[model samples]
Target chain A: MAHTIANKQKITARVRRIVGQLNGIERAIESEVSCSAVLQQVAAARGALGGLFEELLEDHLRQHVAGAHLSDADRQAGAEELLALIRRYAR
Target chain B: MAHTIANKQKITARVRRIVGQLNGIERAIESEVSCSAVLQQVAAARGALGGLFEELLEDHLRQHVAGAHLSDADRQAGAEELLALIRRYAR
Candidate 1:
């Protein structure tokens, strides 16, 4: 609920755009566009999608991490999990 | 709506855990734990957090990118955004 409050709109809009981008990529592959051009488009699409996740992740931290609903052990685990994810995917 | 359908519960649970992890990190700092031990905890926290994002990101791609609601351009942008976020944070 709290996470939704932070990003429902932006997430929705971004998701809509991502859907459109995927269609473009399909067309690009079908039309056999230049490899460079295709790759460029692919890169762009990934970046946009990643941004959406990043925003959501930040919201999770603000809401859950900074909140009072969890114990110290749980908070530590949560932070560890988050840090791991950032390292793995953001790399 | 669809995104929520895919991950509402898992996300909520993970957030709760992340909250607890944060508190643990704070305690570790206050207690003056060894630097290496602290770093280890920090690393663990980052990884866990990153995994949560990675899972959510995958869900986003599955729901929005793979669905029939978007155009080619939007999907490409989504993919690019995802890739960039992965590279940036995973690093």
Candidate 2:
């Protein structure tokens, strides 16, 4: 999406932080950190991932599905695509 | 937790896969892959992370909060800890 390209730096930073968090979990496991601590790390990473998803989803909806210039058929296709993604994600 | 230790390998593997998925997202961004494709990868990684959280939470509930031998006080504390985690994660 054009919006994603426009926000590429922000999205990349978010993704990098999530990668760091995931790596932290691995290190915690290797070091035999307490389960509760590791669980917290996992939850933090999960939340970050969810944030990324939400941003991208919003961009997709705004630019592709609900854009002012989109034809009705294009809008319908975008909506179906989004719905499929939501189903898969929610699964 | 003792349960985490018992299942260390499985947990580590899951974490590794999540890291790989995250790396894939970064690569996709760097390569200027379509937004939809990148979004799908994010969703997949988020789902995997959620699955890991679910596994760890179940283990925590079974061994710490709901264990047959746990004292009432310990059970209460465990439940509180879990609630805190859930709140943080949901936020």
**Relative to the true structure, how large is the alpha-carbon lDDT of every model?**
0.66, 0.83
Q: Stretches of candidate 2 above 4 Å error? A: A1-6, B1-5, B68-71
Query: Which candidate gets the maximum TM-score versus the true structure?
Result: 2
Tens-digit per-residue lDDT, A1-91, candidate 1: 2234466776788899999998998999999999899899999899888777777665554444433454545544545555566556556
RMSD of 1: 17.5
Per-residue lDDT of candidate 2, residues A1-91 (tens digit): 2324337788999999998898889888888876778889998888888888988988889988888999898788788878988887777
What fraction of the native alpha-carbon contacts across the interface, defined at 8 angstroms, is recovered by model 2?
A: 0.51
**Model 2 agreement with the true structure over B1-91: per-residue lDDT tens digits:** 3334337888899898888898889888888887778888999899889889888888888888898998888788888878987887777
Q: Which stretches of candidate 1 lie over 4 Å from their true place?
A: A1-6, A68-74, B1-91
Residue B15 of candidate 1: its Cα lDDT?
Answer: 84
Error of 2 at B79 (Å): 2.6
Tell me the number of clashing residue pairs for each predicted model. 74, 0
